[model samples]
Target: MAVSLTGTRISVVALPWFVLVTTGSATRTGLVAFCEMAPYVVVKAFTGPLVDRIGPRAVSWTTDLASATAAAAVPLLHVLDLLTFPLLLVLVAVIGAARGPGDLAKEVMVPEAAEHGRVPLERATGLSGVVERLASTVGLAAGGALVTLLGPLTGLAVNAGCFALGSVLVGLALPRGTGRAAEDPAAAPAERSGYWRRFGEGLAFLRGDPLLLTVIVMLGVTNFLDAAFASVLVPVWARESGHGPTAIGLAGSVMGAAAVGGSLIAAAVAHRLRRRLVVLAGFLLVGAPRFLILAADAPLGAVLAVFAVGGFGAGFVNPVLGAVLVERVPRRMLGRVNALGDSLSWAGIPLGGLVAGAAVAAAGLVPILLACGTAYFLATNLAGLRPEWREMDRTRGRDAVKRRAPA
Candidate 1:
């Protein structure tokens, strides 16, 4: 997870800076991002069934290793004087492809790990969230320092190393006989369908379960708003506010640090909360105040305060989502289901970046920030009105179903 968290943060921050510096066009930078992410979403959607079929442990390490190799190749080519814009695009796309499956594997492991230890899924998921936030916190700070001191390629180097390290950890650290393997005897039934058919079955599950569908849509919109804010507005706002690139980097680090704090707190107390209500409140906290605070054109201290609060709220979100997913998905289907849901949730990101770039260019930073934040707040809350969210139970429902199966 550390490798994943650090590697992703480094790539995300470093890539944009590299493109912006080299190409000198925000739109073009966004297009590079779009090229990497669009294919990422599409490919990951199909890979979910494969994960379920093959199991997550293999999926995680293999993909991480592949991603590391691709990432390492980028700098080697650059140093060899063979790198070009198109080549950079292809390298980043490869990283994206690997990252999608790697992410699904990690998420699928959370519940299983919890069950193996006789811990609640919420608690385990909270720890997962903390790991992510802590990784972001450390990675963002390191990314800033590396980019500022050693340049963007240095950050990319760190990213590649982290992916390689994460692959090693996943391959070696996790014990066998965790999570879902404890519950199901019939999970790996004789393969009755082709890989494509099984993948379609996963999609069918999403289509039939309105609760899961709503959660996916909600997460998708939230991801879109976050991408717009992070990729476009935050950097532009920092420059316009006279903070420059260093300040942009620092702001990200600060937000990530606050998120880490939030997630750690969540890990300590996540079991006490009611999932549905907390999620609604978290959305309100995370979404409503960001644009308003940014538009206020506050001082540096005030800006940091606003982001800290927003990040804290965001920290509260992921664990609940993770727990919900783990509890509900059959062990055999975890990879495919997780991949599908995650792909849908992340699908809006590239477009969000593109839209934010256009909006910032046309409408200026503050107004667009306000509008996007407001839209995110509204969309998330509106999603909560659906009956499925309230009806779902992360604990009792799936466990009861498992118990009822014949011995």
Candidate 2:
């Protein structure tokens, strides 16, 4: 989780600044980001079974180390006068590819860690959410300062270091035999089945499950909307409102801090919360008003406060989703399911910048922001009222008791 938060913070947060600095073009900056996320979504979709077959812990460490290497190479190449746009694209793409597995590995680890320690998945998931939110808060603030004080390269350097630290932590911290033992012994023979067949099994399971499918779809839609919000809103607000990059960074930090606070609160009371309603209400709160607030272009203080509130709602989101995913899938299939869900959930990310750029060009920023916000708000709330959502809502109260029963 630490690795995910920090690594993503640098890659997503600072990489844009790096591109802008080097190229002086928002379109080019967005393109660099597009390069990273596009491959990431593609690789993650297929890598699920591989993650299940091997183990998330091993994948996490190895990929994180690789990410560190890839990220570090950018600056090193720049220093060597070899940092052409093509080279930067390739390196960033590699970093994005590595990040796919790295993120899934970390997410997969959450359930394992909870199960191994006999912790409630909801509480554990909340903690993981807190870790991510906290990292974003710190990383955004730090990335901003790092970029401002020492340039974008320094921020990238810091990102590499964070990945290195995260790799070390995951590699050393997990139990020695945990990764291997988590694999299904009976599946050793099936592992030799064609890769496509194995991949089909994962897909088949998702197809068979109604609740999981519903959640996946909801998240995917939300993610696409979020992509629009994140990619377009910040830059527009920064440019139009006279907030500059520093304010942009600070806004992210405020959101992260609010999210962290929400996660901590959720962790404390997670046992009592209904998983579906909590998630639904969070989505409602997070999606619409915040975007409208941004679109309104209020005073700086109001913008920050609005984002902070939005972040709080977002903080409530991940833990519930994580707990649901962890509980729904068997440990053996966790990696594949996690990767699959994540891929769908995040598939909208690349489109975020691209769509945002086009939207801004075509419709101008304010109207687009309002449209995105309205779409997110309506989509999430309407989805929450679905029959499938009721299943999760009904289960949470009774399941919490059963979950806490003695082994």
Best by lDDT: 2
Q: What is the lDDT of residue 160 in candidate 1?
A: 92
Candidate 1 scores a C-alpha RMSD against the true structure in Å of: 2.6
- Compared with the true structure, what per-residue lDDT tens digits does model 2 show for residues 4-61? 5765675555677677656766666667767888889988888888877677778888
RMSD of each: 2.6, 2.6
The residue-by-residue lDDT of candidate 1 on 214-283, one tens digit each, is 9899888888888877776776776578765566667677777777777777777766787787788778
lDDT of 2 at 215: 80
Q: Which segments of model 2 are wrong by more than 4 Å?
A: 186-188, 191-194, 395-407
Clashing pairs in 2: none
lDDT of each: 0.76, 0.77
- Estimate the lDDT of model 2: 0.77
